[model samples]
Target chain A: MISSPENTAAVNIHRDDIGTRMGIWLFLFTELLLFGGMFFIYSIYRFLHQNEFHLAALELNVIVGTFNTAILLTSSLTIALSIAAIQNDNKKLSVILQIMTLVLGAAFLVNKYFEWMAKINHGIYPGSDLLLSKKPGEILFFGLYYVMTGLHGLHVIIGMVLIAVMLRLTVRNKIDSNNFVRLEAAGLYWHLVDIIWIFLFPLFYLIT
Target chain B: MENMPEQNQKKNNTGYTKYILVWFTLIILTGLTVSLAGMDLGRITVATALLIASIKSSLVLSVFMHLKSEQKAFKVFVLVALFFIVVSFVLLFSDYSSY
Candidate 1:
């Protein structure tokens, strides 16, 4: 019996979730390598300029960093829960959880903005004269701090966008139980963003 | 082999309470790491902080990312990527530690 062309195509798509996962995992590996290179540079610089890095870390506000850590961690939990909600076919709860995740993410960026503003106000940014005149070790430490955390902030923004889109799709019923791979993939991306910050928290704010 | 029937039956096996538990543990670990920084443990602070961070991230990855239930092939792919991260760290640090 010859199945209709549409039916065959539908079956093929349904059967290839693993391929979809494989593609995303490959993409995630490349991301790992990208951040891994930055970390390599960070380690070498920290080793050579341990004293400067320590003093530089002292300038960071541990309170704000700790708050942002809690915020990001909460957001991670929300996103993971959203995936579970959708898998159980609770579309409304899933959307609510995603929205919650986005709010937590926005809160994190707001906190980060205040932190960076405080630093930039003091001329602590990369290439500022006050920073430029410091020992090269100190300069390198702050430079890596801004670049690593800034890159991480960018990831947070991207994760928010992904969650926003997924939330919209979930609302439209485009991401229900039968087609939740999209939601799952976005959750993985969001978790990676949190994982990066997990490491970043200690290196920047607590290493003093 | 992750047959088609089993794949179709796949749904998240984790309970909602587990996510909360993980989050609580992560928050407590963050507090510990921050407090450790203030105690003047010298170099051990950095080591202890990173060790806790690793533990926290492992929970996020294994549970939240659903790596524990993922196929063995994908698990290997992830492990290989992590191996490269370690490789880059060790080979580069070997050259820099003496300088």
Candidate 2:
């Protein structure tokens, strides 16, 4: 190996593609376990109160849930496409796709806001007096609904911010065809968000 | 290690059409789950919805997340994590169901 200034700089930068990707995957698994705990609690409660679970699920608007699911799904597609575009050296297309992803994520959150407000307006929030008057099973159902969906919404915000950062990097030529690990990592995070919603939509809105 | 290039050497440029096809399939699966929700399938509805969801997640994992092209170590790590989750589920259910 020849000792040189450029070699020293390259070593200092240290682009370890395989290691970076593996680290992200490990982080993602921890995230899965974090939500997995909640899913377990929900299953146990649902089993104990099947009837209330069914009736409480009816309060959710399946149409809105489905529409939001589609939005997240489309967002996942856009992020995936952005990665592909970057991999193909099409920087412009990648930026466009990332913007589309951010738009779709915002759209999903808007729909969620309206859906939550509709329930809140009817006094169905976690500790509202109206909720207190409901049966224990129904109360538990709504409580879990709020907590799970709220946490998922938080993940959406984090993912959007990460993608936005990646967009800036892409524009600055920090993320390009030969150096796109950051963008790929961001894409993985976004897809994981989408996957979580895939299970959440069916479990919360479609199973009843 | 010192002489390694800073640029990533991964040249696998998956086409746009493949992702679109996967997206189409995911949409169809989403539609199926929603439509099935309207029916009174009793206990089977849960199973059907979850099964479809599992399929959809697998698609996202393998394709969109690039898990398919990832190294064997990544796949093994994923399986290990999933195995632990399954074990936890089984243990929790065994205790609760027995009670």
Candidate 3:
């Protein structure tokens, strides 16, 4: 084996691919567990106060929750398509698809804002008098509702930024067809976000 | 952005039509689950909704995430991760089930 710099660089680059994917998967696993722990709390609380949790869920807008689910689902599709475009070396289509994904993400956030605003306007926000006056179980339900959904919303923003960065790189030819796992990694993260929402929807909005 | 072979390798790209098909199926599933929630099916509603959601996410994991095309080692890791999540839930619930 020649110990030349070129040989080392080539091996390292290939290894880096597998290594990076493993790293991202590891990171995502942690994220899943983090939310899993929270879901644990949710289950315990719901079991302790099934009635209140049902009431709390009734306060949520199933329509909005369903719409947001659709938006996230659509975004996931667009992200997958964008990766396919990149793998096919059609950078233009990849960029276009990415832009569409970004738009869908923004739409999700926009709907989220309106949903939260409606709650706030109705004095149903965290720490509001209505919440403080509720039974402990109901309070916990809403608290977890806000916290979990808020965290999911944050991930949406992060995912959007990631897609945007990928789009920029694709446009600049930094992420080409031969090497677009980074974009695939982004898609994976986005799908994870969608997956979390899938569970959250049934737990929070549909359990009634 | 790692994982490229030294020589450019041609990876199988899922067609746009297939993606659209998966996307459509996902949307239809979403609608079904939402409407299922509205029906007064007692305990069955929760079970049914969750079961449908699980199906949708499975479609997403296999297609959108390309888990089907992924390496065997990676697939095993994913399975293990999922197994642990279930284990954690069961173990933690054991404590609460008594309470």
How do the predictions measure up, each by TM-score?
Answer: 0.94, 0.94, 0.92
Off by over 4 Å in 2: A1-12, B1-9
**Model 2: docking quality category:** medium
Best by lDDT: 2
How would you encode candidate 3's per-residue C-alpha lDDT over A76-99 as one tens digit per residue?
A: 989999988887778888999999
Ranking by TM-score: 2, 1, 3
The weakest ten consecutive residues by lDDT in model 3 chain B span B1-10
For model 2, residues A152-186, the per-residue Cα lDDT tens digits are: 99999999999999999999998988889899999
lDDT by residue (tens digit), candidate 1, B1-99 = 556553344654436888889899999998888888889887588789889999998999888888888888878988888888888878897887778
Reference-based lDDT, each prediction: 0.87, 0.90, 0.86
Q: Candidate 1: which stretches are off by over 4 Å?
A: A1-15, B5-9, B12-14
Off by over 4 Å in 3: A1-15, B1-10
Evaluated at residue A151, the lDDT of candidate 1 is 93
What C-alpha lDDT, on a 0 to 100 scale, does residue A135 get in candidate 1?
89
Error of 1 at A28 (Å): 1.2
1 or 3, which is superior by DockQ?
A: 1
